[model samples]
Target: MSAYGFEIVQTLIVDTEPDEYVKRAMSKINAAESNYLAGLVVGLRDSVLAFSMNVPGTTSKDFLGMVLVTQYFVTMKEIGALSESNPVFITHGPGTVKDIASQIRDGLLQVNTTQN
Candidate 1:
């Protein structure tokens, strides 16, 4: 497996009316000189709508820490790119990258169990 580097530079979180915020957020994203931008809109139970935008590159997928490098590290370790002794960034501290990926994946599933 190959390693990739994302040159993300900006992040914007807007909590407001979705209709207005979506338009404004797109405007800003398009106006920016970056080659890539990803956006997500989340609506809560209390009717609170939030819009988040990640700019510049691939790191945008990690919006809420939901999409992280743990999975990639796991794959790398399987292919021998990483060793069991290699430490990786986990929830609070460093841990065995290969060992923690599955745990993190499970935890993320639980956190996102509710869907709209």
Candidate 2:
């Protein structure tokens, strides 16, 4: 992966909080559309992150970060959102976005720094 020079990481912040989280997710979705349309109008970049997800009602804060941590069904339903090369993490118990994000961050803290 390091050979790529610069990596394009896509992250999704999963949570179901007061309406604020939902609004932020929607904003990211719209940003994706905008980026896609811009690429079409202009031209695609050599290295692209292309962040995307199936929000159904939930999903990321950073461009190069975790994809999402929604309910199992929602995550499965958006399987297409992930690249074939990317990894998927599943949590069995209940947790908010922060809880799950923190767990993942701590687990991978040595590997990389998490950006929300």
Candidate 3:
């Protein structure tokens, strides 16, 4: 089996991923970055959406987290490359990655057995 299952060549969902996350994702792919980040998850409330043009760079699509839309400051270790076992950041939602077990522990259906 190959270690890298996440073929970057796959189609990407733009709207679902935030602009910031996209930047980070691209950065991760661009250079060797950390794998895990434990950042503060700030809640998105009824606040006026602001934009800053100084934050240079084209729209990115390499984000990798989803605990909350505002959490991106506490990154433990930046992963070097994408692996087949790496957590796949869901295209939808704020920015949550699927659990390992939940990701691969699927496709199995068992029939209920009756015990006498």
Say which candidate scores most in lDDT: 2
Could you estimate the TM-score for every candidate?
0.23, 0.24, 0.13
Per-model lDDT: 0.50, 0.58, 0.36
Backbone clashes in model 1, listed as residue pairs: none
Off by over 4 Å in 3: 1-52, 60-116
TM-score of model 1 vs. true structure: 0.23
> Per-residue lDDT tens digits of candidate 1, residues 33-94?
34343222223212221223333343423442433454454555575654555554444334
Candidate 2: clashing pairs of residues: 9-64, 11-65, 11-66, 12-60, 12-66, 12-67, 13-60
The number of clashing residue pairs in each candidate reads 0, 7, 19
Q: Give the alpha carbon lDDT tens digit for every residue of 27-111 in model 3.
A: 9875543332211122222121122233344232212122222332223123324354567453443233344223322422222
User: Among all windows of ten consecutive residues in candidate 2, which has the lowest summed lDDT?
Assistant: 43-52
Q: Mark the regions of model 1 whose C-alpha exceeds 4 Å error after superposition.
A: 1-30, 33-35, 38-95
Encode model 2's per-residue lDDT on 1-116: one tens digit a residue.
66978775864756546598888999999999999999865643322223344333222355223443544447665774766746666554545555766766677775565543
Better of 2 and 3 by lDDT: 2
